[model samples]
Target: MTGPTGLGTRTITPDLARGLLLALIAVANAHLYLVERPIGYRGYPSGLTGADAVVAVVQMVLVDGRVFPLFAALVGYGVARLAERAPESVVRRRGIVLIGIGALHGLLLFPGDIIGAYGLVILLTAPALATSSSRGLLAMSGAIGVFVVLLSSGASGPQGVPTVPSIAAPTLGAFLAGHPGEWLVTTLFSALLTAPAVLVGVVIGRSRTLDEPAAHRGRLAVWAAGGLVAGVALGLPLALAVVGVWSPTGTVGGVVAAAHAAGGYAGALGLLGLMGLLGSVSWPGRGLLAAAGTWSMTLYLSQSVVFVAVLAVWAGGLGSSASLVTATLIGLATWLVGVVVAGLLARAGHRGPFELLVRRLTYPRARTSDR
Candidate 1:
């Protein structure tokens, strides 16, 4: 299960599964950045067209709120993995770094910045959830997530896209100074919204269900099927209903704006099931994805920067009033650009630049001047 450097103890299947989770978003975001760019899906307009529309339609049908939850779940699973590898004290310290990163990440929430919110979730929730049993924590987290989605629905009337920074001002300064109770609200938001995914990770870590794919294929098949039906049935209407309905004001409206966000969550789980099936049993691209997933934190942050640069008004200006289809094509091109760049970098034995920085910070030392 572990990677080659003895650094990866993650079960290969689960690692691959989690890797798949991160990549799933690339599909949609590529479109947003390169094609039919949306301001937000929470309550605002999602202006899709052609391929952008097609991707959106498919995402609405499949992956919507679902991916983040999966990401969160994997964090939970990873937390478990960390605890097993080190003392609680060491783990807690690591947890703080994750939180710090997340806090910083949240500040970076602009059209260009992604995965910052995810950093927030790992920081805020993992410490508390770490104490509970996998199943118990997941159940608790899922219930809370459901509550947030439902509660948000009745309040704001419509919300914007969760991942896209439609309502959120595009700068760290804005989130800090402009938004009232931004810290408290965002912290609370991350906690309730992300608990299930983190918990799901814990459950998977605890159950060791994913590691032995061959042994559990039958169970996975059943769960995947069940997830497909339930996820779609619940996610579709809610997502479509909220189209062009979001407004970026007040707590209630924000919650309602998260309907599409909720659907995204459901779709993420369904996708996990789908991807797990494909990657675990028979994926030609598993090695590449696995490699990318191995250095995930590095790759993730890099993607954000790379994506923005590619889509920015200055660089390629692909973000210039393109339809969903056009944007998707742009996104596809951008993705190829990223994959090739990442692959070449990986081949050179360079982990993500960020990953190297974190490693240095986590374990610093003085040079032996005397020697």
Candidate 2:
């Protein structure tokens, strides 16, 4: 058990899982800066060639719309873990810090940043975090299920004109150049999309299931299997569209989109389950990943920083026409750098820079050495 603000006894599984998830997220996001193709679902390119086509196909099946939810779940897990021991004010401070960071991240780096969404979710779900595990679980499950049902049933939310960011040489420059109103709209949409997953994550955190994966093998396995199946089933149609196998239109398209979105939750749960199982055994790269995962918050922002520096139109400008294979390689390289940085930090017994920053912000009264 960890103290509210303490990093506590670091669990190998969540860190390892998060490290892996970060790589997956890298692969998923690597192509977003490429302005050559039309934006499609999950940011998949509409046009593809040779190995790029193959990469796109594989990403659709396994990567896109998958890692975010898993990451969100981890967010909830972290919040719940802290909430179980820390004061509500402390947790709220953490949430506020995240929101501030996320807003800055969006304004300066990636427009599609999920950090802001996660922060909002934490703030919104603070009250529920204090409830008993059963009650929290019920509320989480009910809200998610109801939202999914509504979307799949073809109901609509408030209608607004879809806003698309323009292609600009410096991608960061483009985000900066975009209208503030449009950015806010997109950011709000992103936060709404991420709310359910974060709530579910909080439920997972509250249960402490990941703390002892060996004891939860059966439960983890079942969740993994069921989640994989449900996710694939719901997401198949959308995946088909992504890879050029099918095109969905009108209300049917909307329903498929909803199912695909809901499928992300299942996919994330399944991945978490798999990670829990892997933690039960000593797996290769586990050490490296665990190290990286520990620095997840810092590294997450670091990824965007690196992306902007290397691929932005005004920067490296390498992403405008990068093939899927090329982008994937770049993403992998980025994640590898994170692994190295994390290893170094772990050896020094230091938190990742941003991680420490947030900790300090959240607990200003706590000693600097506390984290």
Candidate 3:
């Protein structure tokens, strides 16, 4: 079931979840690159209308905060699996490489790069992740979750002002100069925000929940049902406000935003549970999705590349001109292209270039045949 060498046997649930996550990430990030707009909750533009409004609402509830936590969970799951086989040094080396790659990606393409944040988490928590008991991990997750909720309360800003000034930087030079500082802030914030999900993922991986979904069907079902319902319910108020339907201000708005942010963890778990259930059954296009998952790191970086080219103010200038609807269409197109390219690579028996790079760098002396 394992891959030719270093990678563990690919499982259906995690791979499928990762493949699906990229699409959500694409749509979630497209609007954040927008410029000359008054930012609102979660960096969405204020005063949306028509289809733009609809898209914003949908993304707010289902995609925005949800995807990143899921991505964090997947990374943690992989870390847990790697820790089972590789030495601690190898795991830390992988984290270091990710940080380097993430810095380059953030500086050159998108300032919202998450790889570095996850790398930071891995670097700091490697020992704890490998040794923590279930109860201990859950306790840490709860503590961090409280902190994240508090952090998210201040996430809202005055509706008519730009929240992230760097996103609207006027010139390429200014954008590049401002990005490293922004990336530092974002990496720290992301690491804290996603810590709980990562710990939860380690718990799930330790239990082999997705690896043997059929044996844990009952638990997965509860997670799927409860998590999804809670996520949508908690996210609704923010979605409404973002789409110009509700106008909660003052403390009420802050509470709503915090609740919405908290819902992201539930949504991530819900989606993982749903994927685990799905993994128990055979379906069409599963291979394609798994292939995309195999190349997820490469595809994720490629998304930023495409977005910067198409939407950055200093590039195509579409960030200032494209409607939310158009940007969403572009996101979907980008994901589709990634899927096709990933499938071709799979068919050709080639690993993703980035995957190869990481493998080579992490295991410097390992032979290609062995790894």
Candidate 4:
């Protein structure tokens, strides 16, 4: 929490804003591996009728790529909250531990893991978020976000805008195999792409707009409306392109789609507004949302384990047995469970078990030398 500046510290009060996004992520990420065309266990499930194709289309466009954008944007938000109360040295040391924890998360969980990405984002981007004027930082973040889509998607530069350094998506194993600089290059792109999202979080933290609902009501409503429009405008096209409803292969199309998915980034931010709108008016559900936010890290890690171990690993592999429709249901169920678990657990005078571990590890030990 922030001390005197009052720029961006909150009570660490829970908000349901990010709870939904994190939950959606489990389902969305699972869908990537689970949905297969009707066929046998190993092959794409064959014999799909037209109905199945339709389901595929909806999931592909809306759910698949959209969730990560949401998750990444939230990570940006997280960094902003921390910078208010902590020193850079503190953020940096904490980031190192997060990187280690993320590495452990990767080793134990999915190879295509997000924790590492989030950790990498913090280690590099925290300083920038701390130093830049929020508006300037936001602008820089927008430029970088656009650049990632344009350059990495192998598309024409943004609006035929020229991009100097094109970034490539690298496989973790390949990344590990490559020279030391390769990993830096990979993370460099992540830092660039995610920085804006983090800045937005910082803005929210500083604003306390989400916390004092009555005071911020009108402002949040306005922000929510703008975010929804941006998400739709940018997200739909990107999902369609990736799903091949539009041509899937071109660099330009990919960039466009990535930008579209970026809409979800906007949506998530606006969602905080939407949540505040509801909570401002409602009494019962508001408490639940706040509770969930309190145990967010626990819920977040719990999400990862459940997805990889239970949801995706169902007999014959998660996708092997389930259709996209089934997978979505599983993901939703997982999220609901997480909220309940978080709420119950938070009131029981504890954080998430895993989160406790993360905290213990992330906090530095006094060096024997220093002592």
Best model per lDDT: 3
Between prediction 1 and prediction 3, which has the larger lDDT? 3
Q: TM-score of each candidate?
A: 0.75, 0.90, 0.94, 0.75
Model 2 gets an lDDT of 0.73
TM-score of 3: 0.94
Residue 60, candidate 2: alpha-carbon lDDT: 64
lDDT of 1 by residue, 140-254 (tens): 7768777877765654443334334332334345434532344445555656677667667767777766667677677677667877676776555545543432334555455
List RMSD in Å for every model shown: 5.8, 3.3, 2.2, 7.5
**Predicted candidate 4 versus true structure: per-residue lDDT over 136-243, tens digit per residue:** 777876787766655545541222110111111123344233323433443455456555566666666667765676788898798678866666666666444333
Write the residue-wise lDDT of candidate 3 on 1-371 in tens digits.
12224334567678777888888989988888776777776677878899999888788777878888989988888887877777778778878988888898888878788999998888888888667797898899999999899888886544564434566777889889888888889888899988888888888888999888889999999988988888888899989888778787789988998899888998888878888888777788877887788889999999988887888877777988889899999999999999888967765677888888877787787764323
Task: Output the worst ten-in-a-row residue range by lDDT, candidate 1.
Answer: 362-371
The CA lDDT at 78 in model 2 is 85
Q: Mark the regions of model 2 whose C-alpha exceeds 4 Å error after superposition.
A: 1-8, 148-174, 179-183
